[model samples]
Target: MDTIIKFRFLGDGDCPDWLLAEINTLSRMTSIKIKILGQTVVKYLTEGDLDEEKVRKITQDAKVELNDAKAMVAALELIFTSSARYAVSAADLSSELQQLGLPREHSAAIARLHTDHCPQITATLSSQSLRVSRLSSIEVLSCDNSSPFSTVSLKLKRLDGNVENSVINISKKDVHVLLTELRRAKSLMETL
Candidate 1:
């Protein structure tokens, strides 16, 4: 017999009793209101803040507590961000939310929004990632008989919009290994 594991859209501690109760009110809200909430969640993902007016409108329409509305907003952010990070499909996200006690209609609406804005969400997150400069160019200098190493020059573009040059010397065997790894990386990238 095979056991199936379901994907969780939110963390274990993410969904509280209050949030679960809040989600039950989703059925009372109009589809347009639900869509607005979903869009607000996506906007927050990209901009890092929720529209207070929209939140107030949603809270008024849903007849739920203001804190509950805020919690719902926070939950939506967590769900979509986790989904985007894990590359979860929209259908799967809906199913996961449903399993978490979200109303089917609201879950579907949120999932559709996830599908529509996933690319932008992913791009925004990747742009915010911490990393070193990106390699812009590479140059190999001629090896002379006086040395048993090759000199390589690399040009990197920093995140701060500055270009930095780097030079390194490598042994012949290391150069061969580096070339092999670089070729392998190119091959893998082409497959993608």
Candidate 2:
């Protein structure tokens, strides 16, 4: 038992219902016991007797996990809605969060994470076996316009959180094929 760190969340708007449920479950676990501080406050202690350095390290680790969870939830909410097929920009998502009544600091943190880390995430998700029903959206990544044969890479995140980074080996014939597919898609939609 180390006195590393104790974390408590007042079950208010600061803590979401889902997180409260997670906290409740954590309260029941054997090794790490969560203490109910009051009617609306739930607290968990890491260990009973950790030194100061260990306490700092453990607290930092916990903060990292919390930040990751927050980023994922915020990203999913913005990028994976029922009626849309594309992931919006972080700035756009931040504005949305503000509209939803989240504090600016909270929304800005998520926005910064989305802009900074989401490109890698999008690339990873696009490479997976994601089954999206609607037309795909591309996160503009990079283009090699300087080369004799230019190539472009796009990152995509599917509705189900799968990521992919696809590169197009573009040439004249490839351009024609792409145009043909676009025309076919337009025709099919017109028929419907």
Candidate 3:
């Protein structure tokens, strides 16, 4: 069954037409319904001299409907002008991932990581720190069973091992140098 999700956008003042268009485009792509609230709806209802209390009451009542519809809330900050932020309740994304048949623990771990660290293109675990290679690749490596300092070395060895590359023991201080050498090697190989 397709899950129907709703989203409410609260704007500081009269909402821009472009913003509404963008939301509509997203809704069309995702098959979700988006509702506008706060000053945007207020302006639509009363062109001038709107009563704040009345708007608040209407907003509260509409919010009840939104809650019943499993809608998430969001706000657009005028200060940012072009940026939009979603107000996602904690674990909401994890729950969605779980529903998609992902292991609960793994989903929770990924969600927590996303909350703590912004999206990475290409990321792999090396030692205790993460090695992010691209913003779009967000891959993770775990050292759950390896020795403390060998984790990153193990990763690098695995990556290059298929071509008969020799393994190297890595210290924490050697990570940068190792990455630089790896990059140079890759560049040289590309030219061959």
**Candidate 3 lDDT by residue in tens digits, 25-124:** 2222111112232233223222434344543454455443433222212221221111122334327645643443435654454345434432121121
Query: Per-prediction TM-score, please?
Result: 0.61, 0.29, 0.20
**lDDT tens digits by residue: candidate 2, 65-170:** 4443333333333332210224566666556555444446554654564555554444544544353333344464776767556576767555456778888878
Residue 172 lDDT (model 2): 40
lDDT of 2: 0.41
Which of 1 and 2 is the better model by lDDT?
1
Task: Supply the global lDDT for candidate 3.
Answer: 0.35
- In what order do the candidates fall by lDDT, top score first? 1, 2, 3
Residue-pair clashes, model 3? 7
Candidate 2: stretches off by over 4 Å: 1-85, 130-192
TM-score rank, highest first? 1, 2, 3
Residue runs of model 3 more than 4 Å from their true location after superposition: 1-85, 118-192
Write the number of the candidate with greater lDDT, choosing between 1 and 3: 1
Across 1-192, the per-residue lDDT of candidate 1 in tens digits comes to: 955444655432355565466566665677678889879889988988778888898778668788777777776676778788878888888887787667787888988999999999988888777444444333344443347887656554543567766676887668778767756755554443
User: Residue 104 of candidate 2: its Cα lDDT?
Assistant: 61
Question: Candidate 1 clashing pairs?
Answer: none
